[model samples]
Target: MSADFAGETARLYARFRRDLPSDQAAELAAQLGLTADDLLLDLGCGTGQLTAPLLPHCAGAVAVDPEPGMLTGLRDRGLPGVVAVLGADTDLPQLGRVLPPLGALVVGNALHWTDEASALAAGAALLRPGGGLAVVTQGPPLWLGGAPWQQAVRAVLEQFLGPVTATCGSDAAALADRVGLLEAQGLTVRVSSWRADHPVDAAWVLGHLGSALPGDALTSGGLRQALEDELDRQTGPLVEQVLTTAVVARRT
Candidate 1:
């Protein structure tokens, strides 16, 4: 999340990536018993995607990221009472020392990049009793869903971008391990999931892909034009089915 979302790449991420649905956030807030007296810690909070939506449920937020650009974008958001920190999951214990007790901890499409056990334990330690940690997989990787449009996009990506196999840690196996980590901390586990479809054209698809691409690869060669043209040709009126999941674990 840090290296990938730096400088203009960070802006690309902010533009293409979306916040979680507000209704879902509200339900989660209610389930977690979040109140205005509470504070949230958004771990690996790239561009504050999780923070922005969930912040309204709480009094304030502490958004932490390892990338400076990410902090910059988050700060630009001007979220009231937000304290943007330049740090990673490993820095959580140190953070725990200074911040107030946490009401909820959220990792949105990000735990895959961290040392799962350590980060979760650190986050758990920061939470007050009855508070929770919600880990969200904002849907699968852009190039790796099972829909026709998804497969078509993968084909286009493979033709130009090599094999498109990264799951951003949302694969079934990764998710199972995440659940185990949550349970290992002795928290009660429950999940909320749904499927929805969105309409998109080739440029939308291309920009989403660009957001995930590292550094100048999007600007590198003939990749951009080639992808858009080929994608438009082989693809139909595009509809992508997003399978979203939220693993909410609450401390007793």
Candidate 2:
């Protein structure tokens, strides 16, 4: 992991709590075919965004992250069937020892941050025979139930992130390879993708980008003003985004 990632993540989590939707969790849980007897280990589980939705599908959850603040938020949610653990991706052996053999292991957008090979190796160890590993990445700017806003957000994000067409980790494919690793351990691997029409308000967009914006250079109001101006220039009055993804290998 990069030296700055942890600090950046803490700030991002504070912002994400407001902007990110829980619906993606439901989608992921469904895709993995989560069952009542399943024990899921959530990799890079941030503030229980994915953890909360998995509660209904699984008997229990092990939410892991290096950030204490993120775990605190998950705790604050008062979610049932959740056990939040603080650790890094390489700490999987310790995690495995803490939680029993898991039926499924999952990571949301943060899968990009971990060492893919190590993660795959660790996940293979954690899941029992025929267990599954779901590595998912979300991308493209879109608005909830608003086409115009979606266009606006896309334009703004492209400009902000600098010509990024999609959001996928450099190691996304390797992370998915965990399915093959599990297969070697006796599990069937299923790789797939899904789309969702996610919704969000202007405040949602602003909060999502808040922490990443350089506060020393621009005040909160200033950043908001800039974003509003950009949105106006890109798409005026109502926008909706098409939420797309590459979900690789949900081991069955």
Candidate 3:
């Protein structure tokens, strides 16, 4: 739910797209019963990373990113049947124009950036009855364990950038909040948490952090290399983190 971590985040994700786990996407799609008839909306869609992969699975999908650069990146990728819209999370005017009543609306890690009440209200209004909403997010496990490398990266990243914590993460509380929010709007909530063992060390942490860093932070490869080298020196590959969570709800 970070509004500030757009540019560098997009750049880093653009790089990560090469390593995307399509298996994970397929799993989530199966869990949600995503269909070609289902209209999916990717809210806070960063560079259409999720949006593009979703095209082959869903009937049609629309990706909305407020950042133009991110939208351009998504467009350059040329995802067929997926339309990219440039708009805000709370107000998706272009979505209204491009999509019919959505069968599924996805807010990937970006819902945390919106006003909770407002977003919930909008979801209630936008989705068709029986439609589903999925909130997906990822973060390092160090945040939970207070591990040295995790602590180290957070200290520096927070120092350099603002606290771009994954607020609506794979936590029980955050997932519960999504369920509660949906139920409050008279929707059926189905919540599930799945964790993936990602190889982590200082190098991996730096790559992940680099994804969250500001745009200017990545302009110089030397600076990126220096940071990565620092991370490598501090921590070895022993830090394997569990990448988790996909909270899905349905509008009844």
Best by lDDT: 1
**Tens-place lDDT digits, model 1, residues 1-252:** 224777777887777777777877888787776888999999988888889988899999999999898888889889898999999999999998988888999998888888888888888888899999988897778678786767766786687668878778777887888888989999988877766677777778777777788877766877787777667676357777777788888999
Give the range where candidate 3 is weakest over 10 consecutive residues by summed lDDT.
138-147
Angstrom error at residue 180, model 1: 1.2
**Most accurate candidate by TM-score:** 1
Instruction: Residues 18-49, candidate 3: write the lDDT tens digits.
Output: 32257767766765667778888888888775
The sequence of per-residue lDDT tens digits that candidate 2 reaches over residues 1-252 is: 122334555556555543224565566666666678989888888776567766777899988988786787678778887888888789998878867788778776676577866776787688765566776554432322236555565555545444534334523454356555655645555555555544555666665555434343223335457667766565343334444353434444
Cα-based TM-score, every candidate: 0.94, 0.74, 0.79
* Predicted structure 1, TM vs. truth: 0.94
Q: What ranges in model 3 sit over 4 Å off? A: 5-9, 17-20, 140-148, 155-172, 200-207, 215-226, 238-240
Tell me model 1's lDDT, rounded to 2 decimals.
0.82
**Candidate 3 positional error at 88, Å:** 1.3
Candidate 2: 10-residue stretch with minimal lDDT: 137-146
RMSD of each: 1.8, 4.5, 3.8
